[model samples]
Target: MTPETSDNRTLPWFARPAARTWRCPPAPAAVRDFHASLPDYAPTPLIELPVIADELGVGRLFVKDESSRLGLPAFKALGVSWAVHRVLAERPESGDGAAPGPVTLVTATDGNHGRAVARTARRLGLRAHVFVAEGVHPRASAAIAAERAEVTLVAGSYDMAVRRAAEAAAAPGVVLVQDTAWPGYERIPGRIVEGYSTLCAEIDEQLAAADAGPPGLVAVPVGVGSLAQAVVTHCRSRAAGPSASALLSVEPRAASCVLDSLLHGEPVSVTTGETTMAGLNCGTPSSLAWPHLRDGLDAAVAVTDADSDRAAADLTALGLSPGPCGAASLAGVRAALGGEGADGRRATLGLGPDSTVVLLSTEGSEANPVRVTGT
Candidate 1:
């Protein structure tokens, strides 16, 4: 595929820092404390990529690998498990703060989040009801069912499933644990964003242990922008550098809600339909996260299906079996660093030879099996 030229591009947004402090509302310390208490909780690897770093002409490239977080194939467990705990832990009949009741957790997903919610519900002796769009990845659907949750297939896209799940959550004892936020429904999605902060915290500690400073830039795959919010919150609040890290929000070209919203200066629904990167297939930015992302991010990049598919193969060669969604950040890096507007974007965003870059490899190769081989 030819490189996307600026004249014909629907990609890349270079942002100026907001006049206000670029911070999200603080997450509860209890979420992090709860995640730490889990037996399976462990920090995923922060792999240094000398080869890609050299090619990208950067000082260093570090990937926060999230393929195996809390025994799940993707990083969704960090948010899902923590949100589940926060919801249950607040209940009066939490059984001496040990056993939760026969509640049901409901949510919609392209794949990983639903499975994570289901697994988290099971761990707490609660039932789960997961909703997915009709065309979700087959393996993801099967995996959600494997967690013993009742899976309902919706007729349209991920957003439609989200609406359906919201409808289903009206039943008594059923709680909607969604990642995207809407009007009057910001609390749980806010908690979900908070849960994701654990990864950013772990990345900070790991970098410090290696005597490395904070990365100059962080490129994250944006679905509804929850993970990006976490990264921004951590980097802004505790950055060792004089300034916050330059944030690049990456999304599927077909479903560039964050990019579209930023351009319009408000939330706008994207109608390009789904792309291959299922997890990043969101059509609208989360209400809770749009403010942080709109002000704090340095740029936004949209990559094509081919771009992410190729990135998945390249990451696999580097010993990380990233699925298409996971590798979108890498693809964004390529597009941002090598395309026609590369020099302009770099200079505009403060990325130079002295810069260190971090990419969030969000999941393993579960969404695309044909292009992936080994673990």
Candidate 2:
């Protein structure tokens, strides 16, 4: 089939060639080494979308499938678990890294991050107290609880939940292992970004195997932008050229922090806009994640819930299990492929046949197995 194509009349804002300045400082050497040893930090897998790639006029489309990441079923497990483990290891004097003690490992979550922290705490014998918004998926809360963490569902938006988590983090015994940073809390967020670096290392190997080589266009979903930061920083530092043309950050139109920051050259917060992909409904990018996205990422796009739903269905059709939030990059990729796409319902984001496209299927349905269709 001769794939039809559309060009964007309004070009995406290009982020300058920002070099990554993240410091891999010596903080928790033992834990960092332990995280490195988990052997589980492999690149998962990357698959092709032959029909969609061809239909959209792209040379090849690849998805770094996170549906089965670490057998826990999402990429959040990578960062969360690593952070929780490191936190526990750093405070060894806190006794057996197991059992609920006075000290609580606290953080707010849209879903996946909490599960990762909770899972890591339970695995290593530590206590966890995860704060979440009331409307967060019951399954996500339950998953955290399963790890023996006390899950507190706060009322209001994700920002409210985060504020509450921050308050709790101030308790003398509570250590905040947050995915997003504010004020003095930056270590946990940095760990989240560092942990995410493992994903890129895996993608490199996966891309090499397919012979489609490295991707030219990579569409990564951005919540607080930590994941996008990790992917863009690693990819730009390692791969570039025709095979790596652009690093695209896709956000829910309602909460496009990365796009707004890239456009204004500053971290500006937005009101929490509604979206079915709750995990990506963040209004502000992580302070730690901001610099990387602004400097390393090439462009940003906002996708709608309808776009994400269609993407979810398409991935399911491909026999790939994905949640609404998980399949989001596909939604952006589809939009970029079509002309005047930023305005249409069925628009797409695509590139030439030789322009290998990579979509980061960042999360999985396990967080919220069934999606509530959103407008």
Candidate 2 lDDT over residue span 143-262, tens digit each = 889889998888777788889988887878788888887767788787777777777766766778777666667788888888876776666665444344467788887777778777
| Model 1 ranges off by over 4 Å | 1-14, 17-26, 93-101, 239-242, 367-375
Q: TM-scores of all models?
A: 0.92, 0.84
* lDDT, residue 106, model 1: 94
Q: Kindly list the per-residue Cα lDDT of model 1 for residues 1-375, writing each as its tens digit.
A: 122366467455545544124554455667677789999998899998888888898988899898899999889999988877777768676557656446889999988899899988888777899998766766778889998999987777778899999999999889999999999999899888889988887888888887668787899999899998887777666543335678898998888898888877788988756577878888989998888887777778888889998988888998998988899999988888885677877765577786889999998886433321111
| The 10-residue segment with the lowest total lDDT in model 2 | 341-350
- Please report the TM-score between candidate 1 and the true structure: 0.92
Worst 10 residues of 1 by lDDT: 366-375
Candidate 2 lDDT (Cα, 0 to 1): 0.72
lDDT of each: 0.82, 0.72
Per-residue error for 259 in candidate 1, Å, reads 0.2
Residue 219 lDDT, candidate 1, scale 0-100: 94
